[model samples]
Target: MKALLVKDNLPDFNGHAALYQMTPAHEGHEFVVASAANVPFSGPETYLFPADADGEIKSFAELDGSYRGGLSHAEALSNAGYTIG
Candidate 1:
């Protein structure tokens, strides 16, 4: 399964917004997106976004069709402190 990691732009959470990991909803994971660090998918920090009617999730796309920021896998990995080069 593929996933995208990006900053949460919503102002309500401000600096508290965890780096979000977005992926298509599947059997075990029902959320379209959640906090990247929430592996077990629990706790208040584990923010979840509802999936589409078809159960597919697209990164950086919203209801009004506004453009949001996106990061490549390499960039996300680096941002998550998993790599350096």
Candidate 2:
């Protein structure tokens, strides 16, 4: 099991925005990133990197889990210096 930590201000599937942080999951956590040209998160999940040249989501693995996929998105989030509320 894993956890997804999405930021505040990013809306959910139903176009509602009610952001909150976790109390720390027993399992490791991943981040939910939002960049330009993107819509608010709209699903039971989320993603990080943008699409690729072929318009497929390839850059995603570059910013996934803490070790396996690459640099940890959780660490990346911490590196940004924002306190998790």
Evaluated with TM-score, which candidate comes out highest?
1
lDDT of 2 at 83: 39
Candidate 1 lDDT, 1-85, residue by residue in tens = 3444444343333123223333332333333333223223332222333344333344433311111243233333333233312
Model 2 lDDT tens row, 1-85: 3323344344332222222232342222223342222234532322334332222333444333212222333443343333344
Q: What is the lDDT of candidate 2?
A: 0.32
Which pairs of residues have clashing backbones in candidate 1?
none
Candidate 1 off by > 4 Å: 18-23, 26-44, 51-85
Local distance difference test, per candidate?
0.33, 0.32
Q: How close to the true structure is residue 59 of candidate 1, measured as C-alpha lDDT?
A: 47
Give per-model CA RMSD.
Answer: 12.0, 12.4
Work out candidate 2's RMSD over C-alphas: 12.4
